[model samples]
Target: MGVRLNGRTAIVTGASRGLGRAIALALAAQGAAVAVAARTERVWNDKLPGTIGDTVADIEAAGGRAVAIRADLTDRDDLPRLVEQARAAFGPVTLLVNNAAFTAPGRPPRPGATRAAAGPPTTAAPRADWPPFVGTPVHAFRRHFEIAVFAAYELMQLVVPDMIDAGGGAIVNISSVASRIPGAGPYRDFSGGVLPGYGGSKAALEHLTESAAYELQRRNIAVNALSPSQAMLTPGLSYYRTDFDDVGSEEDFAEAVVRLALVDPQTVTGRTIGHRQVLDGSFDPFGP
Candidate 1:
């Protein structure tokens, strides 16, 4: 009834703010004991707001169970410890929302580039899109993949075994529409901002999700990648565009993830479902 998670436990990465925070709260409200993990535990800078502690307090205040775990997603070594801590706080994680990602704005573009780069290159603006693909540093691009793909893989390895033993579980890899837009079909003119580094990373994550889903289905574990059917106007992105046209809300995403996380593993494994599709009970991602 209404996707109850009563005895389940969940780990929401990047729960410090934005989508992660919203998803964590949603899970807890649905009766899941949530573990909020993020590097930001307290306010050190005014640029970004929200923290694991804040998320936990919000969850607890609403009469739900949650714990905060401070972790840096870039550091692969910290994942096991993070998972261990979550397990200790609640139990084996039944749901893992891999939403943590790194995308720093206003960084100097590649050498020899100047005003030609995308976004405000030298603005004091609170939010700006990433530099052009050619201008992005290799290391910087690698970090996006590290957090979105590699970090997620490491965490999956840790929780998967336990998930199998406990019967079944779900893994939701939070991705972006940037991963697939302006493609080879009739929808080729769509321009929802382009940053190859972040986009490539998300594409790889979706591939990993499909492959993992195929292999893990026998174990009763489902892996799916989800992206907002439309652009999301989060606070970070809002600084650039205040208009909410054709954008989905954070609550929409959180609710979709909740439904996906609670679905039957075998029936829903290996999909790259969108927010609207999940809400509409459209399991066939390729259906017209």
Candidate 2:
């Protein structure tokens, strides 16, 4: 089951790894020329695997068209250059995936540090001594919102003109279920690392998605927010020893995004979709 994306040009931010990388490869596999953008071009951090170069290499090796662009999403000024670089390599970007996120602040807890310890614990926990809202620094919240919300908005603005000129296009904002369900719920029921800053940013992104989709519909462009129904065992989550049994596949997100990208703007705009809905064939982006 493959979607046809021939003759389309796409720009996928955070394509160096995780969900972004998976989406980039899926788009390219369907014949879209992809611009894989991320901060890491090489394996500078041994702990973190994947890079823009690595993504491009895999795409090219698999006979898909792609190019690597090193761009930091945190720096607002660098966004236009990212789109420009992508356009230079693959023409105007009609498919934009805002997938990069600032993750420095909301990491899982450490190992065995007691409540009396000066610092925080080593593992994930919702304990009083853990780094929750009270323990989290203000700067961390600001940084996360800036990257996850501001950056995604700016990137969408950069690509709209091109998409309009091209007669139509799609923008997929990769959000998380946390945006809707915050605090200790089914997904957040884990031990530690339950910060609302990241989830708040994603919530903002989803709102932006709906707003953009409504305004852009007149121009034949479709903008939507999509999230995995469950947590994914990406490198980051895996670091905390997150069990994959209860999580969904990264490909679930990738496939749903590709499907959304191919849909007509009139039928599927101004909505936040989920991977489970997409898989079950009940994905109604226009539904209330």
For every model shown, the clashing-pair count is 0, 9
Off by over 4 Å in 2: 1-3, 104-131, 183-193
Per-residue alpha-carbon lDDT of model 2 for 1-288, expressed as tens digits? 134999899999888888989999999989999999887655433345788889999999999999888787777768999899889988988999998886532322123433333222334342233247886788877877888899898999999999999999999998887676545455735544555777889999999998999899999999888888888877655544454468888877898888889878898887888878977878655576
- Which run of 10 residues does model 2 get worst, by summed lDDT? 105-114
Error of 1 at 35 (Å): 1.0
Regions of candidate 1 where Cα sits further than 4 Å from its true position: 1-3, 106-124, 127-130, 182-192, 239-244, 283-288
Global lDDT scores for all candidate models:
0.80, 0.79
Cα lDDT of model 1 overall?
0.80
Write candidate 1's Cα lDDT for 1-288 as tens digits.
234888888999989888899999999989999989987655433445677899999989989999998787877777998999999999888899999877545322232444445234333466444466788789888888988999999999889987988899999999987787445565655345576777888999999999998899898888988888887866455544555568777888899999888777657878888888899875574442
Task: Kindly provide the TM-score of model 2 when superposed on the true structure, using C-alpha atoms.
Answer: 0.85
Error of 2 at 269 (Å): 1.1
Candidate 2 scores a C-alpha RMSD against the true structure in Å of: 6.5
